[model samples]
Target: MSRFYEIDPTPENYWRAIILFGRNTASYKFALAKALLELHGNGKSQVKLEELAVPYAKHLAQHIKQQPKQITSKRSSFLEQITAYNQGQLDHDGLIQQTTRLGFNNVIDAFHKVHGNDVGSRFFIDQRRSHGGIELTDNLNHLLEQLSAEDLAGEVEARWRLVEEAWANNLSRQLMLVEYEEHDQQLIGIHSQRRISLTSARPALNGYQKGRCFYCYREISILYGSDTPADVDHFFPHKLKRCDDGKPIDGVANLVLACTDCNRGAQGKFDQIPALPLLERLHTRNEYLISSHHPLRETLIAQTGASREKRQDYLQDAYNCATVFTGSWQKWQPRAEGVAVF
Candidate 1:
């Protein structure tokens, strides 16, 4: 019966067979790998997989059931021979023959004869990410219960050990890619029109009234559908350009929460800088940009054709341009009539 499949029918490990007979489509590849990981994590039980695995999972249920038992014999079915095979009981060729002698070579012949190395490499990456804790998590164990279990022996066991050691290397998924942090509050409040929109003069609206394009204010979804008020902005972006390997800059030093309209309109009109969706979420409540900070303002000035002194002048300019001629400051605002240099 074991001859019908390889010792490691782990569809995960059998690439050649998969490539020869199966169309290696992306969806197929991902689905298979995901299924394999799900199975391994669940301790290989089909009865538990009804919901996520659906009908196909049910079909594989029996095959998964019988396979594990065969490999995990209750009384160590081929005990003495397994002992000899495990303890360097034979030469390399002899070990190969040991399978024939034990009448189990058929289970592995497919593995030895598959398509290419792609399957092996992918399976290896997956294995590296499924460590003890990653697989043993509450959600994961429940997930595992749905798939059939495998006897964690031989190559599987050895590979698992190596994976555990290299577990930290697998961080992309573990590092949950979220646009905003939990502390990020969506700012979507209707402020009274009387609020001095720094074009109304505080440090806020100086950029546009002074000639630089005022960037768009952002309105990020706090809980997925909330909008925020517009904050002041500088459409021409400025910041420390990140290195090729560096992550997106999320520090307060890097972002200025702007109003939604401003953000949408700014759309990389100037230098390439990422938008701060977090602050935008909070903007629905208030039109505050990094409106209260110094660095964001300083960076903005620096990005303009400002010399260091000019940048410093604005950063500490006791008389903010927006506040200069209160009438002009109050009246000067960003109009689309400006040049569309973008």
Candidate 2:
């Protein structure tokens, strides 16, 4: 069973699992995703590959112009043609022809696979055999109704940017160190003293949290201008920054998304150490983040410890020190009916 679907079983969460956990050897998946979102339900159940080529090629072309290395490979005939099109060697018509022929070769097959296993829901069915194109599934339609296409598109964009930036900089494994800047609440990538400001910590994290508040497990929106925006909360209060002995208290490992009610409401966890159970939950959440791809995985591993046992000790020690400084800690009691989404 797909763990992501087990979390919420909603079409939106399934789509997010594809975006957050699917492998990215190239940016083709993302480009194809943007194309699908652009063309999904505009009065058509299916789109011919040639028709799909237009937006597919356009998105890839735009990204090629912005960032050159769209694929991990040094050479891809598909990308080469796109580059030629960008350089004026290939005209728009010729570009579309090449995209029709070369694109959709792998992405269509791999889009629904997360970590090599099929997701529980099908967003689109491959119909190239019978229809010479792809057919939009009811799952896609349902997801569109649940969340605006614009919001989903933004998520694809955010995930794409993070992947491409990390690839462009060759930041893999421990080479990349990410730090949290509390002032702007954005993650910063540090390597060789050069700091690269990455995406907002909210969207980068909300998917992993499955769009629910960490404390209450209530559904939360990562959207910036939404009526009730989720807060990028520090699990161990920010003031306890001094207790970690030099480890960054603002690191990604300690950050969790909290709904406004659980964050600043009358029962908010303002400056108090979370109850013991919440600490264990934080450990589980951090491990989940570590299992994910580069930058975040590396960042958390760096901030916490290299091994699981060490990580457990690190959090426990930090929690212990936090309890001491606070003098007396209150156990945060979440509402009785709150669900544990993670």
Q: List TM-score per model, in order.
A: 0.17, 0.89
lDDT tens readout by residue for model 2, 1-342:
446567578787788878878898899988888888899757688899999999999988988898888888888999999999999999999999999999889999999888888888888899999999999888888888766676677677767777887788887633767777878878777877888786677877776676678888887788878876789898888767665557677788888889888888898887877888889989988887777777677778888899999999999888888888777466675773356767
The candidate scoring highest on lDDT is 2
Cα misplacement distance, residue 108 of candidate 2 (Å): 0.7
Model 1, 37: alpha-carbon shift in Å?
Answer: 19
- What range of 10 consecutive residues in model 2 has the weakest lDDT sum? 328-337
Q: Rate the local accuracy (lDDT) of all candidates.
A: 0.27, 0.82
Against the hidden true structure, what lDDT does model 1 obtain? 0.27
* Least accurate 10 contiguous residues by lDDT in model 1: 194-203
Q: Which candidate number would show the highest TM-score if scored against the true structure?
A: 2
